[model samples]
Target chain A: MKLEMKDSPGQLVAALTPISEYGGNIIAVIHQREPESPSDTLGVQIVLEIAQERLDALVAAIKVQGVSILRLGEERLLYRQSVIMIGHLIHTDIGDTIGRIDATGFAEVAELNVHMPAIAEPSTALITIKATTRSEMGRALDILRSVAAEKGLLIVEPLAGAEA
Target chain B: MRVAVLGLGAVGKGLLRMLAAKPEIGLVLTAVADSSSACIDPAGLDPAAILDTKCVTGRCGPSGLTASDVIDSGAYDVLVELTPTNAVTGEPALTHIRSALERGKHVVTSNKGPIAADHAGLAALAEDAGVALRYEATVGGAIPVIHAIRDGLAGNRFSSITGVLNGTCNYILTRMDDEGLTYEQALAEARELGYAEADPTYDVRGIDAAIKLVILANTCWNLGVTLDDIAITGIDGLTVDALRLAADQDCTIRLIGEVVPAENLLRVAPRVLPRNHPLVIEGTLNAVMLSTDMAGEVTLMGKGAGSVETASALIGDLIAIRDRYVECG
Candidate 1:
């Protein structure tokens, strides 16, 4: 979020205090003084990690500190997993396969890299899924497994903890 | 220690060759038998002469004698069962092991059939008769993993066991990743290189790896699950594009057999793993990762199958039994 506040001592701390109280983890705070003109109000950008439900509370609390809110942006998806699928991907309704994850609002297919050699030959795809949480990622993989089983496709999941 | 051997196949011949070379090991070959014939001598039979006979006449001894005859009333203290495996029935080897155990004789075997069939029952039978029943050659040949679980890591509780138990499937997958070959091409290479069998269904279909998981689960956790309980997914239908896709992400696929006791999970499938993962061994080498409480995760890697490699496991078990139970003359 971007905020415009008084260019004075203790005002930066006042704006940051409400972020923590409302369950927001502050990642970065950019506050620079311009060399050409010294403005009465200072512009600051704060990047934070917080759940969507708490963002409204955080915004209201920061406003109470007499700071004007400029803008708010969010990157919701945090967890991810990748799996390879092999079979007749296109013929088996590829759009529906991706829509299955998208329908689950918490998770979605982030990318689908398909390799199609011939029409009759079975196509292979690598699908990467992104989810809001770890449990939701598991649920997304479970949905992928069912879709594979139904479409006679082979799903090769990455070994858990292999990356570690 | 007087010892009797059954089944003069590749493993048997390799064992006899090793025992013949190392006489100071104190394991006297008292009786040896091929499928159709048996040779018994209370004063210890000659392994060198018997191997020569098997090579020449295609029989270890006269056809009048058989393996069951030796198991019933043989001049031996240890019975080494090396018969062909019928994973379903665990046939004649099961009965042979039972008889030997009942007679207060130590039993060691390379046959997964009998052990995978009735491990607890045979162990109980051996306990009742006061003898050790060892089958180190059964899974992960020459790795000594059974000993690591049952004795070396005895007090530690194993949470799970994950491994590449089948060598043929590993060979095929490794080739596919290295050469960009199709499944058929890799399998053909495996057959030409002697890694795959003429009928590759058992290895390629994941049954071989699942059978090994059953043995490990029964030994480690006493789960009592069989091959039927394992969910198997083979590498037969896997495509080259799948391997390439995995490679794009700096990963590779292997036929992994996982046994999680707490979850009652026994699964064999092709799973993507980081290229440098501990279980991502190449060629026909076998690797097992045992997750234990006290010891953390311990991995064992070695030759999974070969004439001499499996014989080495049988020999280790034999020496273990000799040092613990037998009276050396």
Candidate 2:
């Protein structure tokens, strides 16, 4: 579960109480980005197992504790898709492009290898993305397409006969 | 509980001082050991030199005063190994560690050589003897990498573990890049600042990082890759100009130790990372990043090395082991 909560003292404990109250043992809690950073809110990703009927209660309990649930769903990204994006990747702000794809709930860019020939010329990027389902993979491709259009970069996604 | 310090070096002295401040822990320093008369002088030591009141144990000679001598003396329940890393000279310390484990006494160590060289053997012995052998200070100083991987992230499937494990080399390289200091000047500065050793080859040539990588690899992946399996490249060749170029491109050149298992092979290397990248921004501060299937990428950053910081790790492990023993009982 990916949760976005207020950067306050005891906020993490507040968010975690519901998990324990609902009989969920938290396996891991990963807080990405510093809490003091103004531009970025605290992104907490927790791994826990709960009964299917109690999961709704867990989410509701967390919401009652004042934690904003950004994305809460089953674990995805077990399957991976490797693609090569050939275009002016360097000139087109490749980091922003990659960030957009990662922001989508379905896919995460696992590995990115970029080759730059010259400062002004186009560069090619080899990106490997992990997704849960094929439909989610298609949505991620759409997000990447919009990012590419905005940045004036071309993307060669999902090589021939590699769809799963 | 009575505690006997095996060595009176920086780490051992720091442990004595920290134990003095924590009255709730109910620890008593019974004996202290060192090779020279320097151990006798407790003046100017922090925490008011509580160990000075304790018995001045005999010198750490080659043959006399074994680690078992201190353990068998019946004055301590825990053994803290703070001896310097020399396989031959430190063999006695390892012997003491094994004996303590065999006798079901908890052992905590800040010495990397003993843990890096004999982790599996010692772990097996500790398991067989039903004792705790905790070495959190061996890898990332006080960063809690070992416990974080072994306990915190126990449920995750760890895919890869990477980090900048050596602080001496990182400090020298960061100084050279940030201040345009020559290699000799940086080396001199690191030595003056007590970061680098006299020879400093182990840290500069990536051998130290290799040892840390091996520990993390064994802990996370159970791949059993030894120190020889690492493809180590240090920061000796990195120049200020090269660092500047990397920084100009929104990237930083750090001596990264990476272990990636893909295509049924384990690979380790030092690579350049983007400035926005977590490990690159982690700078001077030691950072270990574990990429797992569930958590994506998790990075932990803190002071990687220092006498007090590393000693604190050792003490934390000691406290944890003690608590576990109480709970078990």
Candidate 3:
């Protein structure tokens, strides 16, 4: 199960409570995010084994805890969005910047690659985000714009060229 | 299920405390065996008297409480072995453990010497007798490295494992680098802090890490690599200047244990890692980094030592075994 949980303390524990209450054994948890982002939401991929009868109760319990269930089946990486950031990424604390983008409710920054020439020079970061839907992707970009404005950085939304 | 703790040392006391706290686990403490007579009480007769009359019931005379006594008594469904590390003279504990397993009882231990030296033989015995030989606390103290590799990451083809296997050595190095202490000063501090043993050779000479590496290599890569195959290096010879130099270059000097298999060469070594590396940030804590072709790199980090942490891992293995028994039966 892939879940998008509110990026807050004890949210992971709250989300897992129902699984344990329903007698679900969590085999593995895969969570990766940019370290510097505090508000950045996290994508949790859990592999669990529970009875078929308890599956509905488990999902209901998670929903009660306000956790967004993104994908229910075996499919991994159900949603993906790519964005480009242009500005002084290194000067503005790249880790914290990534955290802000991830802290948004709609998306998580899964991958980021930055190019910086000098300590004081502006750099560009190619960030790939994962979200539940296209609307969530737009909301994530809005959060990124606010963060960029506050950090004196620039955000360049990806443009799709006309089809041939 | 009733259980008996054979040694009331650090690990033994920790196990007692953990088992006592878990209400879901129907554990009854029936007996205890310790070499020290100073801890035993003869008046109350019940072993619980010594534990403030909380859980333990009967008291065995001493460490001489043989396997036959524990098995024939039929008071315990499981035997916990937390004796000191002595592969040569510790055969009695091994004997008791084997007997327990053969008699259809479960066994949990934190003794690395026996497991490193004779895991195969004991595993076969446990399988034949339809019992469990759980030793999660033996390696990496409390990090769950053994279980994570054996079960959680079992699906992946483990290509290599690199870690700072010894907490004492890591502590010594961390102090030397951070505080500018000399090797002797750091060793003295470690001894004072109870991190290093009185002799300290096992931890300082790299043999400790080698044993852990050998176990991981055997389990993960199926290489059967022994302590002799590992190129062991200690932090004894390193100077403060070298550590400072490494720190200046965006790297930290750590005693890393690595098991790498590429093409024909299988390698295990203790090397330095950059500061940004996850293992470097692990600091005094124990961390194991595993690399696989499919999973890329996965690192598990947590407390490497301490009685409670190690005992918790043992309890986790015990619960898993119990659940499996319930499923199978």
Chain B TM-score for the candidates in order: 0.98, 0.86, 0.86
Candidate 3 local lDDT, B1-329, one digit each (tens): 45666776777767767766664565557766665421222221333344443235333354455545655565666678777877334466777777788888788888776676666777789889888888888778888888888788878887778787888888888887789886689899989988899998888777787778777777776665556677665666555544554455455567777777773333333344566677764335778888876788888888778888988877887777767663422
The reply for model 3, stretches above 4 Å from the true place, is: A1-164, B36-68, B71-74, B87-90, B263-270, B326-329
Window of ten residues with lowest summed lDDT in model 2 chain B: B37-46
The DockQ of each candidate is 0.52, 0.02, 0.01
Record all residue pairs in model 3 with backbone atoms less than 3 Å apart, i.e. clashing. A36-A95, A37-A99, A39-A103, A40-A102, A40-A103, A41-A102, A41-A103
Q: What value does the lDDT take at residue B85 in candidate 3? A: 76
User: How is the predicted docking of candidate 2 categorized under the CAPRI scheme?
Assistant: incorrect
Task: Order candidates by DockQ, high to low.
Answer: 1, 2, 3
Q: Write candidate 3's Cα lDDT for A65-164 as tens digits.
A: 9898989974222356554465677777888877876676446889876655456655656577776445466677778768877986644332211000
State model 1's lDDT: 0.91
User: Which 10 successive residues of model 1 chain A have the least lDDT summed?
Assistant: A32-41
- Alpha-carbon deviation at A23 in model 2, angstroms: 45
Judging by TM-score against the true structure, name the best candidate: 1
Clash count for each candidate, listed in order shown:
0, 0, 7
RMSD of each: 5.4, 15.5, 19.4
Best by lDDT: 1
Q: What is the TM-score of chain A alone in each candidate?
A: 0.60, 0.50, 0.51
Q: Tens digit of lDDT per residue, candidate 1, span B1-329?
A: 88999999999999999999999887899898888999999898889999999999999999999998898875898999999998899998999999999899999999999999999999999999999999999999999999999988999989999999999999989989999999999999889988898999999999999999999999998888888999999998799999999999999999999988777678999999999999999999998999999999999999999989999999999999989987677
